[model samples]
Target: MKDIRIGIIGFGTVGSGLAKTLYEQKDRLRQKTGANLTLARVADISITSLPKEYSDVVLSNDANDIFNDPEIDIVVELIGGMEPARTFMLTAIAKGKHVVTANKALLSIHGKEIFDAAVKNNVEVGYEASVGGGIPIIKALKEGLVANRINYIKGIMNGTANYILSQMTDRGLPFAEVLKKAQELGFAEADPTYDVEGIDTAHKLAILMTIAYGLDVRLDDINVEGISSIEPIDIEYARKFGYRIKLLAISRNHGDNIEARVHPTMVPENHMLASINGAFNGILINGDTVGDVLLYGAGAGMMPTGSAVAADVVDISRNILAGAINRVPALSYLPEHIGKPRITPMTDLVCPFYFRVTALDKPGVLSIITGIFGKHGISIRSMIQPGQDAGEPVHIVFRTHRAAEAAVKNAIKEIDALEICSAPTVKIRILNPE
Candidate 1:
């Protein structure tokens, strides 16, 4: 049997992790898969020095080298963006090479095109690393659990933001201070916008929903809310009421429509997801037969993610040797058989809420606030008035029953206009996930 040659693009972090893993575990991997996987080339933006082990393999910044090399059987893309990554993956497929990528953004934006190209080229594209780092959730959905109808998927996708929020709630640090510490620790990126602002989670959700519901949802269509405005005070109150604040990405099938939303949510403190702290990811999936199944692990890291990519490469090797007959479908179903699931608008999502209201401390202030909720057809399930903050103002907590987000938004607009309420309400949805 001949060795399977692999060319890795963007040899940093996960890229180098894959190279080192394949090099070190060559004999073991071959024994497990009956395939000899070899890292024949490496590409990246800047080069310092090769890791001595990959001395014979071609080392160049030019990605075209991988395509031109006849020995390179597979192109593994770990580059994280859309431009050159997407273009390069398509080109590799056109050259009749198999591709395995960890670029969720590229797939979320240009998946249809890339998958079409792979089908046309009669090659396979593996994206197991794109959804969950080491958690094989993509394979679970696309293979093992294919028979069940997935009713809902709720995930704690971003780890950096989760770490910050966990610290703020547990250690009582302010949001800004904790975020600064996260940046220094490298758990968070220098910019941190995508991670903290919910865009990164939304990108992963966009990919997950496509596989779960077979929906071609636009990124803009998913309701996204960041944890930027989250306050320690709100976290404290949520804890007092037996809930933990978590940035959750959720998608559910609501009859004919599927609802997808990413936001700071209040999960019951007793729930398993609430206990998932620091830089880790957990996904709770519900199906008709499987009921509730939970998947949790290190969401992002060099070797954990690299392990996933290596598994894909091995699977591709097997598929190629098997004549590509029994491989799992790319999107978990045949292309034409995938029905277009309708995405429910954000306003249509109905859920309970946790809102903090800062108001002028005075008599009948509660009445004025309750009046707005009444006017907008909203009802309050519980209330918390901690007291006045020195000479500043009064802070009150209101936990409401499930209500249409549109109604809640309308009531917020009215409350913000009132002289009793100082600003727009600080809102967070409550998820029981039954």
Candidate 2:
């Protein structure tokens, strides 16, 4: 119940922003919570990198300084990686110090071990910043919406991917062109594989799955498909069909099993998520009682992510003052309740699909392809030959009724192998969660 001393690791953009929040609002926070919060020490590879305004705070090149400090009640980790961030968090837990982290990749991969250690050591772990930056989606899932049974979670969780896709959709630009533009504007990293390939979204989805379903879900459990494969023409055809394309991270709870996937989805333009464009995040959560709710905001940034970390700090600090250890379980479920669920394989997933097949535009070419779909038990709901189906190279667009994933892929394989096929089929999942 005394003053809760805080130590911060990784003095980068997010780290400095936390220091600012604590420094600027120190008095206001203490007055409201009736708990003294101190920004005691900060550690990084180069302490000098921290600005002069933070010179009064203790600076250390070695994180062990904070890990070993007995008075520090909480450790805020802002380092965004799999290495020292994971080790630092573990050490903090081992030392019986509460932890707050924004390292989604590390948590998604090694969270079980870190959380197990926290439970054994009797310390709290706050990871509100891991998924939605400043959106507070983590808290909402774990606490705010605790009473409602979650039906599904679909989100545009990655800003860089969303921005790229939005640019491609709005300007009729190619993926590469939009990607380069995103990088130039500092919205994306130079190496944007994780962002473009849906790896980052998968990581976040894994964490959300764990929280929502009480499952020990791993990143690999989710089926991942990136937006880099999306072509401008595909976007054009999607718009023609009254839809817009966005990279969506999705999960659905099916009583006994769960569906987890991250891919470029054809969302109806009328849906709330389709309107979420640019460097923004929109998470559409459907609960049995709540019906529908959308959490939208800046998905990632120095200030936005830092705000999330600070929120965790406040949450953990309140727990410390209450002397109620583990007042809320880290992943929203009690330790004994946490277990893995059967992940519905991608092949077993049933959804409407969009396919753009390029063929030789010869007679009977259409029948061969339709025959393959029939063989796979997929029925076409709509078809468009675009300009002419009788050209040297044909671009045929088709939308199908709800069909199995295995059936669609099998049909695509057969269609692509034919001599009349001009290019590999462009396949995208359609979002029709009605």
Note the Cα lDDT for every prediction shown: 0.87, 0.90
- TM-score versus the correct structure, for each prediction: 0.97, 0.97
- Where is model 2 poorest over a 10-residue stretch in terms of lDDT? 47-56
RMSD of 2: 1.4
Model 2 lDDT per residue over 322-375, tens place? 788888888889989998879998998899999999988777888899989999
Residue-wise C-alpha lDDT for candidate 1, range 1-434, written one tens digit per residue: 66899999998999988887898889998998787898889887688568887887788888998999998999999888888889999999999999999998888788888987888888889898887788888888888778888899999998898999999998989988999999999889989999999988898898888888777765776888899889898899999888999999999987699888999999998898999999999998888998988999989889989988998998999887777733677888777776665888888878898888888888888899898898888889999887674545688889988889999999888888887777678889999447
- Model 1 ranges with Cα > 4 A deviation: 389-392
Clashes of each: 0, 0
Which numbered prediction scores highest in lDDT against the true structure? 2
Please state the error at residue 349 of candidate 2 in Å.
Answer: 1.1
Give candidate 2's TM-score: 0.97
